[model samples]
Target: MLEFDFCSTVSSIFSTPFSLGMFTEPLMLLAETAPPEVVAGDLAEPSEESLFSVGGILTLGMLIVLQAVLGFDNLLYISIESKRVEESKQSMVRKWGIGLAIVFRIILLYVVVKVIALLQEPFLNLISHPLEVHLSGHSLIVIGGGAFILWTAIKEIYHLLAVSDLGEEGDKGEKGNSVTKAISLIVTMNLVFSFDSILSAMALTKSLEIMATAVILSGVLMIWLADHVAEFLKKNRMYEVLGLFILFIVGVMLVSEGGHLAKIQLFGYHVEAMQKSTFYFVLAVLIIVDVVQGRYQKKLLARQAKLRLAEQPSA
Candidate 1:
């Protein structure tokens, strides 16, 4: 009954938005962070090919699908972030935020391809006999982005717990978000999320056009799904706890990646990226456990009700 009411309320809230979407950062978070792989062996630069050529079309199609898969975490973040805004303006914020993401990605796609080597250069380094540290623009970005996400996740969790009754950060979750601020944060994090996948895309092919096309297509899909994802979460609030924890873990992974990129070492232990396969396996286990636990609890409640009825008849 509680769940049913929640659904009805969600329907009333989003009835007009016909709305809108993350899927990537968390996967990276659970795995070891590594610099984007630059494909080995000299591959030919992307050449201008006929749009209708079988190879070009096939490559473009594969990339589009891949972008959607890789961007799920990205889409999830957008969905969650949009909910932090004024209810009346959520639809607009989500739509505009995604539009900006598409544009920023395209611009970033070209810039990274042009000056990627410069971005990879380490700009600072320090060392001791058993420990060393280095930092680069890329590493800095990862660290900064990770820190922001960590702060946001922790803050949201606190809000969920109502831990602010004694202070300013406590219960103002009902306040409307500044549209500008929300959009800015979305765009910034979206770029951080793109850093790796964009590199992976380059490793597969040299054609910038193919990458751009895939990005645009995926953004379109995101715009379509964003509202719907937000609504689902609003109705099924329990799952939002799971989503917040995933975001928190993603922040941890990004920070680890930054540490790895800087090649930090302490007490003879070098920082490293976690393996992707292991993280996915763990995520699968968590989902299975949550589902089983929920079902088992429901069954237990039903059993208790039966016992109560039997005792009443005896009395």
Candidate 2:
């Protein structure tokens, strides 16, 4: 030990900085301890600080779940809309669309978190008496988005029912808009769909970080699901009809929400917003009915095939 190699020691000392530089913060963080065990639980069995963290996490989780639920329609819309592009490019469009939507959502979150009240401010008024007509920026977006989606859904239904191979036609450049137009619409609708969830999240907990996290998580999930939905529709075209119908209902909800934003009343009946629970219940019923019908149809087909085989003479 007294006769240490001075050259080797100097080399080793110089290499220590290089070794440390190679390990990034993230790499170092991989060996973290359990916080409570490491910090001795900070202050005892449980503290207000710990409880507050748990509450924040719970709220974040709730917002995330809420965003996912409300974004079902938006995801459906993306799947359906991406068909306007070349078949090979549809998936790319979906991924990019969602990526851009997430960016836009975070930007919108910052903007809305600061000026939600301004968005809800009643400015433009067409009438002011018993049939008081007024509008806010928020109401305008909701109403316009509702009308756009309603038109799109109804148009898609009509096209699907009246003519076959709408997707194929688009592939052939016969029933499609420009790719730019398609992506623009996707982003716009995503914004409209996000408004409710973001507003609700703000109301629940005034934490921009939590709300943004929720939106980002929801966006990631939607991106993952959009592919599955598009693939499912491609494989099982029959379900496209069901998806379109659900989208139609989404439009109705948007319109109702917009009406609530405007506080419009007519014939002693105030135009009100649809509850999320009610919307989900109705959607569940629709899905159940569609699934039951699909199973019944399969059984009927199978039975018919059996009957046909029985009627065929021995080969």
Candidate 3:
């Protein structure tokens, strides 16, 4: 101790912070606990590798998966919208529509960060007794989106159920000029659908780098998968009806969610924030029953047709 020099003392003082090892302690514990441990050498230092080295890749994968799951409803809407175009152009419209929508979303993502709090403002209220309701920026998007979805679904269902068929058409009718309309509808709805995801991503991380990375990765996944979703519906035929019904339910969900965002209350109860798990559960049961009943009905019709043919005199 009597031999201490100024240089050594300064070095010791500077090294104290590093020796404390605030960051390394967590990594050591994480290495011990994290799966797929390496055993090439002693686990004491973790081979000087970072425990969070792969966090970027892992986060990208997770965001992609989450985006795909959340975008199912958007995909369904896209497919339905694309059908308004001529058969030859439907695929192209879907591809381009989704592409443009992604670009728009990226722009909106940047803009939203500055105005995130604007979406939370309350514009109006409800009756007495502390029951309140108001329209905020977020609510406007959601409610408007829901209303649009509901209108489209109802129109499609009506056309499917009531309209006789596509039938014959004049040349002008055949050139419905519907492709542009389809693209516009899809792009508009895509923007509407982007609100929830963008807002959620903002809440998740403050880093613009992280948010941008996640959004771009998710957009790429949607672009790759949207066409497949459309084609699946095109091939299934019967599932189109099911898809329409699902769209209706999604519309209802969006309206409820928007109302909640707006803080709207009905009577004394808040109908908007009701748990949608129950709605989905009941809908699943209903779909199962509908499928069984449909199969039974088809079988009965087939049996009747067979009996009638058998009862006919031989030709």
Ranking by TM-score: 1, 2, 3
Once fitted onto the true fold, the runs of candidate 1 whose alpha carbons sit more than 4 angstroms away are 1-50, 163-173, 308-315
What total of clashing residue pairs does each candidate reach?
A: 23, 0, 0
In candidate 1, what are the lDDT values of residues 196-252, reduced to their tens digit?
Answer: 677656644556777788889888988898888888877666677777877777777
Worst 10 residues of 1 by lDDT: 1-10
lDDT of 2 by residue, 1-315 (tens): 011232453355456764322222211122112121222222112323221476667666656766776678899999888887788788888988898999999898777755665776778776645665568888989999998999989998888777666676534633376677778889989998887666555444545666677778888888899999899988887788898998998999889878877878775577877765567778889989999999999999999999999999997
TM-score for all predictions? 0.79, 0.77, 0.73
lDDT of 2: 0.72
Which stretches of model 3 miss by more than 4 angstroms?
Answer: 1-52, 125-131, 166-177, 274-283
The true-versus-predicted C-alpha distance at residue 309 of model 1, in Å, is 4.8
Q: Which of 2 and 3 is the better model by TM-score?
A: 2
Model 3's TM-score against the true structure: 0.73
Which prediction has the highest TM-score against the true structure?
1
